[model samples]
Target chain A: MIKNQFYVISLLVILSMILVACSGGDAGGTSESSGGSESEAVTLKFFHKWPEPEHMEFYEFAVQEYEKNHPNVTIEMEAVADEPYKDKIRVLMAANEVPDVYFSWAGEFSWKFARAGQALDITDAVMNTDWKDQVILSAVEPYKLDGKIYGVPMRINAKFMVYNKAMFEEYGISEPATWDEFLTACSTLKENGVVPLAFGDEFPWAASHYVGDFNAKLVGGDVRSADYLLTAPAEKLFTDPGYVEGLARFQTLVTAGCFNEGPNGISHSSARSSFIAGKAGMIYIELEEFVTVADGMGQDAFGFFQFPSGSGDEGDQKLLTGAPDGFMISASTEHPEEAMDFLKFITGPEMGKEYVKRLGIPSAAVGAVNDETALPIVVKGVESINTASGMALWLDTDINIKIVEVYLPGMQAILNGTKTPEELMQEVHDAAVQAQSELSQ
Target chain B: MKRKFLNQLTPYYFLLPSLILMSVFIYLPVVENFYYSLFRWSAIDTTLNYIGFENYTRIFTDDLVGLSLFNNTLYAVISVIFQVFIALVLAAMLEAHLVRPFFGTLFRNILFLPSVLAISVVGVTWQLIYRPDTGLINQVLRAVGLDTLTRTWLGEEGTAIYSIIAVSQWQWVGYCMILFIVAIQAIPEELFESARIDGANAVQQFFRITVPLVRETTLVMTTITVIGAFKVFDIIWVMTAGGPNHASEVLGNYLYRVAFRNDEMGYAAALATLLFVITFLLTFIQLWLGRTGKEN
Candidate 1:
């Protein structure tokens, strides 16, 4: 009798454990299926890549305000840092645990997810609604693929040559408008014992930005797009000599002692620190970082210029290196209506103005980042992005990732002086060919 | 007969939970990994194209695979030299009473300090220490007027792998030494005393007794070091990210890059399968050699 009681008790314990293990998910499902009434109480899972305290402050405020307004909805939020977020999102998608709303770059990065049917098609919701008029059209353009929008742009970002004005004036250097003048300025800075450019290829994306900018100016937009989309024929695919010339120009910057030593060893933040401390003359920085620069070096100390154009006119010199980063609703969300509502609220004009004021990023929402809400430099940056002929999306995101894999490391090798421009281009050409084949498949 | 059967079944009943967990977690995924390896798939997409050993063929021909394998081999060999062999000598010295009592504990604690640190922390700390301009190593070299000897420790192709391997040694050698120390402590002191009385010196007794007695521990440590070397990912990932053009790429890092970064799930599955085979074969060989040595 005692032994039988013990067995019965053990079985009961195991059953209870299993029940406890499964209860949380079951409760969520039950709540989800209860009703779509106003008091139904929906839980939306939100994921984003900004976990930094500064960004988090804005995000937390936005979430709280949204939740307060919609008492029936609750947001379960999760955030990861930028780099790990890229890997983590894929894992989550693979595990079928994608959050209802998430952050994504508005390029091949988000396009891949959209192509895989993992992202919701928000085209009708964005275009048919008043949201279309609220955002800058240019910023919203990148989110369109195959004539449908998959994401809503939140911020407009672009790269610029931000310099310490005091140091530049101390060395009698002015903003360069041409490649030759830029090189001369670098030489002058080097002679003055200041690092002309604070370049860090540790992440390699920093180098890719330069190459992307150069390629845009040298290779032209249409040809580059043809190559990027792998729509060009085999003979013309990434075989442009201008591609080699673009890499060669970057190599010239390296050979001219235009950057800090062992750039491949340094992190971008460390390089930014050197620039902020007046140890480096200038850095190619994104507009989003202008606020951080202002905070570090006082609002009046720094000035910005577009990356100087080379003498070549093969490409549109007015093309700026940048794209909008935005948010997407997952296709698998159980609460699509609620998820879309939250995305609209978070990316709307009010939150966008708050984004600029609090987080210091230029908002994609039209007229959200005036002088009152943003720093003077940020206002100028937004104007530049607005007036540019077109935005050159980041190389790492704009191009096919397989090709990016080659371009990034190949650029690092150029920084390391281990591979020549011709050699690197050959590798890039081969990768483009492979990408073309994969596209056909 | 019923009681006997019940007694016999009790051990299996006790093991049932663990066995089920292992099947669900470890064994199931491994089988699924092999099945997925034969198909071209992406993690985000629900499409799977049956590609039948094409990924395996690609792995054999891939230059990155060859480079990663070479790096893994280099790591294993170096780890064996430092963590296994050198740690054994250090453990033997500690057990031989060469140091005073107070300092012995101090030294052991100092040696084991790094192993307790998180791998991410260690990788980050070493990255700061290996910076070309402001890093500790370079700063020290410049301070002593040995600037020529200073190099980008974790940046350049020539130095990145070696620098990462050195950090691995710094973190793991102590742990391996502790294992050796424990094994050495378990040996009878009377054996050493008898050797001493038989006209054997410290070196002679160490070779004849301590070394022989700790053979099993040495085998275990060597196998662990080798497997750990092959499985290295966090340090390399956090530090160089298998760069200045993949100078420090290993199998695990390459697998992760292909799977998550490139979204090539099938190819990554193949790479994972290859990694498992390599580790399994090496462990089998080591254990087989150990058994043969015991038999002899």
Candidate 2:
């Protein structure tokens, strides 16, 4: 009887433990569902890679304003430095702890997230918004795969050359009008004891940006054809006359000792600093850098020009490259409606203009206006690109992700003389083909 | 029968908690990694499809993978041998002759200061020191009439990896040094006195007595250092980013570039699993050697 009673007691204990575990799990479920349904006050975490002080200040002001307009909703901003941002986001996603909203580039790789239903389908909601048509179509297109809009573009930047206008005039050098003229200018700057181009091959992509722009321009900024070519099976970028010509032009500048001494040693920020400090003659940088440069270099520091003409007149004058930067709602969000509301408030007209005004980069929204006094060069730079024949996406975004990891380093090898252009191109083609085949169904 | 069963089950019960923890944290993840290596998996992808060794095949065929492996192995072996040896020697010196407690403690703390700093801070600080034009190292070299020896340490392809290793060694030496010092101090004073009576010189005493006594400690430190070198990401990521045509590519950084930056989760998983296998084998070897040395 005693042993039987003991057995009964243990059985009861185990039953209670099971019941507790079940109850605990059910409570978690109930809270999530209740939170999703209720229209009560909520805080949505928004993660981004913009951790720079100036950029941080701008977003802080915009988000605060957003909160003021919507009393019930609060945006909790979690910003990480650019280098670690992607890894942080990946870890968060893998653990199912993704933020309500986060910044993502508009690309094939980012598009996969939306296609997999990881990104919220914001197509209908975005279309019904007050400033629905304000976003640039091209900037918005990259965010859409299979005709579903998953993100909103906030900033559109064009790739171009920024040089010190005062220094250029002082040295009696004009902005190059052709590829030949560009080389002459580089040599002239070099002979005059100024670094011709603040090229930082150490970053690799800095050099790739120039080559990407040059290639695009050489092909008449033929994005449509390039997109088609990208989708097709091609083994050789060198076989493309445009690519070879572009590479030759890039090598011409390198061979002339146009870049800083020990070009492979210079970093992107170092190059930026050198150019801003009036130490280097030219640098290839995104449009957003103009705001920081203008702020740091004071008002009358620099001027902008499209990458000097490549071959044909029309191609030379083309936009060359630019893209949008913005945030998207995570589809895994339990309270997606509330998340969209937060996004709507943050990306609204007032916030958009304020962001662009503070950002110094051009707004993708057509209705957004720039503060001229703060962003003279940026404004002029945008105007030049907008009036051009077309805009090309940066190489990282233009090509597949696998190519970016492989081809970029290979190109760097060419610059470092570890491999020739022909060898690097062949290797890049093989790697890309293999990656594409694996990615394909 | 019950007693026999209890005797057989005792060790298993004792091992249960640790076994459970290992399965949850280590073994399970390692299995998952191997599983992922054979699939098309991304953080964003809802559906994972099995692709069957494509990722591993790609790595074997790629030139970049070979280069990265070479760099990783070079970093691990070079840093481990040099760092452990130097740390052991310094610890012996401090414990043997540095009888002034205050000065010894101060020096030890000062040397360990770099290890305490954040990796990013250490990387940036050393980068400035290695800067070609306005860096203090180059400036000091010029001032001392050693201008010819001055070079862009972090910029040059030939010297960048070595320079980074030097910085890593400088930061971590103190950590190992303290460990060695503790191990050496625990050796009985009687053994040293007996050796002294036998007319053994200090150097001979160090080799014959101190070295053998601290063999286990040496093995543990060497293992840790090897693992630390294999997993080195932060300082190199911040400093050079495995660039200038990947002259400084290590397995960790290369895996990072593949996984996060490129969004090739499966390929990166394959690479990471390979790295884990390599580390596991090396650690097993270390443990085996340590046990053998201790037994002898």
Candidate 3:
């Protein structure tokens, strides 16, 4: 029995040795084969957040096209849904294993990765190449922090008030021209037993746009970011009285019964549905979503208007609250040039044109959108972006992530009447100061 | 003597691989999490910044943490009562009917249905039911002329946490019922027969005989329900996302937000360790009580 056991153990050891030998041989063979070739084989890992059926078409096709053009570079693509994409990127960043080319939102979101030395400072690649002239400068600026470019813009989006045209006509009012007109319109609608804003604070960012637009309009886009990013000196720390005023303006809307009943309980989709179904007069939603919402509601039901002009502060109120989504290359990538090439090829005018021509999303690559394929309402929305003052990135995207995390729930508390705006903003100010001190340390 | 010595080590040889795996994957991560709990860190940092006990101090001082712990405590207390006492009543009724009735398995299956369903699916389904505008609750209230009583079940602060608790009870009560049924079945018929002969009524026999006999099973269910209550994330995450400014936030949900959303891994680790210690002490106390109850 002991002899039999020895024989079995020897056999198992032989089998394991064979397996290891085969794996080693496989690696050796691949390197040898590539060594003989003129085109050095390099594999690039590409990660993106466009896993939806409709969205995947162009991206998959573009990857294929890029690979065909660059036989030396092989692109491996992994597309994930949005929330999980953001989450997995953080985990990857923690492990120091970020993908070579990955989706990034411009402004403070991308700045976090850049500050960590994860993202490549691709100023030369973005600015020196013909691609520099292709993307809009406003779309390009958010990716620039500390006078260095970290990413290239892929898509530009703005938040606009999409009002139900039928509701507006029936109420004998056009789109509001100023803050007072907007409040008057809301009060009139509420008195007539019509819900004015089909909005919910359940998705806090959806509610934050009111404060975001109001902040930009009141404090100006530049000062908003300075305070939001906590770049202000330690003594100042987002203490502008205008910050409180902007929040108070939002609270005023809640007090005026502008939103649907139990706004905190409902979801974004529910609010959008209510507006489309004519249960409410207006909704403030992202500009990119206009095409989808209008198509769903049948374009005749609604029309787009930018958030009304606020007269309370001495700033250019014409600026739209908006940001662009983009792509960045990892600093650790072995093939930085190849990754930059991929980013450029995908985010250039052709891809933007394809996006606009096929999907009707307004592209950051200027003049890429063909107005013919888009609905007239979508065309109108695009026209507004072209004519507008400066664009302010989304509040959550502009502010330090930790501060925004605190601010969102604070905003929700204010909207729900659990806390006053003064208290919430005070909490936000404290968090901002804490973040600033940490950075200083 | 040699053979006996070899045999003594055989069970350990069998357990070695799994024991190593458990130590590496489970125990190692737990140790690392504890170590990390001492520090402050952010997404941008290459390494943990050790602040030593500041996170724990924050948990004690932070109102959100207080609220979260309070919510979790309510969940544990409410869920255990429903899963143990109420389920026992249900198990008795169903087990009695199980012998003579045609609809016995059918009723049991209907009750057990929610347990079989995925928590996310159950959350989504309940979301529709709790929806204020066209939801079944408000619709029924309006139909019955009790419209004034209608309020947003999942949105309002007062109702949100309880609304989620109701979902938890609905899903788990049947699982506990099944356990009770098995324990009741295992009880010998002769004891009950003697109780009946002694002029004990149904309630008397149930209280004197069945209740005392199922103490161990009751303890098992209690432990399971209590631990499950503290660990609940998926249902609450999907249904409310600890929303409307954290009206429904529990410790587990708050830990997730602290870790992922705020990118405060150290603070999250601290919160997790706190939860682990609390769960451990509570479980030890429970098991101790169960043993003492048996001795008595």
Q: Which predicted model would earn the best TM-score?
A: 1
Pairs in clash, predicted candidate 1: none
Instruction: At residue A210, give the lDDT of candidate 3.
Output: 78
Error of 1 at A425 (Å): 1.7
> How does chain A of every candidate compare to the true chain A by TM-score?
0.95, 0.86, 0.90
lDDT against true structure, model 3: 0.81
- Give the TM-score of each candidate: 0.95, 0.88, 0.93
List lDDT for all candidates, in order: 0.89, 0.75, 0.81
Question: Could you tell me which 10 consecutive residues in candidate 3 chain A have the lowest summed lDDT?
Answer: A29-38
lDDT for position A35 in model 2: 56
Candidate 3 per-residue lDDT, tens place, B1-296, comes to 76577557666655665676698789999999999899888655557787989898988888888988889889999998899999998887776623427766877788888899998899988887888877888899999999999987888778899999999999989888988988998999888788878988778877898898898999888887888788878888988889777889998999988887778888999999988988898789888988898787
Top candidate on lDDT is 1
Candidate 1, residues B1-296: lDDT per residue as tens digits? 77677667666666766786798789999999999999988778858999999999999889999999999999999999999999988887777755636477787888989999999999988888988888999999999999899997877888989999999999999999999989988998899778888999878877999889998888888888899889989999989999988889999999999999888999999999999999998899888978987896
Ranking by DockQ: 1, 3, 2
lDDT, candidate 3, A98-139, per-residue tens: 899999887888998888889999988777778788888777
Better DockQ candidate (1, 2): 1
Candidate that beats the other on TM-score, 1 or 2, i.e. the better one: 1
Taking the tens digit of each residue's C-alpha lDDT, what string does model 2 give over B77-180? 88776678888887777766434264777777877787788988998888878877667888999999998998767666677788888888888888888888
